[model samples]
Target: MKILIIEDEEGLRESIAEYFTEAGNICETAASYSMALTKVELYRYDCILLDITLPGGGDGISILKKLKENNYTDGVLIISAKNSLDDRLQGLDLGADDYLVKPFHLSELKARVSAIIRRKMYNGSNLLLFNELSIDLQAKTVKVHDTSVKFTRKEFDLLIYFIANKGKVVSKNAIAEHLWGDGIDIADNFDFIYSHIKNIRKKLVEAGGNDYIEAAYGMGYKFTGK
Candidate 1:
């Protein structure tokens, strides 16, 4: 999952980002309201960890309003030191899916974020089914028909990307960005992505799964549920 953490505290922001990154999430941080606004305008996130108190002149609720105005209907989780009932109610009124008070456990935050994403995007279901294949997002397990299929980390990430953007032309760059973030240089990532895709395809086929990935020459791959 892609997440944006908007927090002014350097240590807290980094800690949250690192924890989520280790949990197979693409995380980005913004230390100020302006920076967070720019990121929200530029990229789409599965969930946003927004801090109600911002260093800049603007408030986090303003950002949420702008996102709603711009049709960004993704899950938004508010994180702040403001724990009053009024604050929580106001945040929810501004469209926050959940509220996490400061000094909370990272594990709890992760669980809440996952729940919000599942509710918003997956209809409160953890299992993502495509054809005869099923992926348990919470369990990080994949099954072909009724049997379990083992997969490497890369293979699982690739599959999740394909499933998330099902029936869409997923460019090599998109896959790379989703999997590796800004670490790998784009020119050097095509071969690696192809190899991962090849391995995932081979493993699924060997597991008695139908092929749903189609390659588009000079373009990208598409998951058509074929």
Candidate 2:
């Protein structure tokens, strides 16, 4: 799962990001409202950790308003030092799924995130199965007909992207944006996209899995599952 931590406290932000990353989740941080806004607008996260008090011009509530206005229905968890009933109620009214009082244990936060993701993405299920392939999201492992399949960081990311957008034609530009973000500007072309896809396909098939990726000519690639 991809997560965005929008907190002003540097130490707390790093601690949260590191904890989540060590648990096999992709995590990013933003110390100010503006930086958090930029990340929220550009990418889709499974969950967002927002802090009510910010260093910049805007607060987390305003950020939540913008996200809702843009139709971002993903799970949002507000982490704040304020323990007032009105504050919690206000955050909930603004569409936040969960609220956590500050100085909480990291384990509790992780549990909340897991619960939110399972509810939103899997209807409370932890396993994702597609044909002969199964992904144990909680365990951070993939298997093909009970046989384990190992994947590198990029390869795992690419596979997850494909599974998430299965049966749809995903363009190379979209893939580049999701995987490398703005870093793609350094590349002259999308040759790296093709290379990664080729390698991923080869590995999956070599693991006794069926090929599901289809070339879309001048467009890009599609995971048809047929």
Best candidate, lDDT:
1
TM-score of 1: 0.88
Which regions in candidate 1 have their CA more than 4 angstroms from the true location?
A: 184-189
What shift in Å separates residue 212 of candidate 1 from its native position after superposition?
Answer: 0.7
Question: Which residue runs does candidate 2 get wrong by more than 4 Å?
Answer: 180-190
Clashes of each: 0, 0
lDDT for model 1: 0.87
Task: Give residue 63's error in model 1 in angstroms.
Answer: 2.1
Checking candidate 2 for backbone clashes, the offending pairs are: none
> In candidate 2, how many clashes are counted?
0
lDDT of 2 by residue, 141-186 (tens): 7888888988777677788788878888999887877676545678
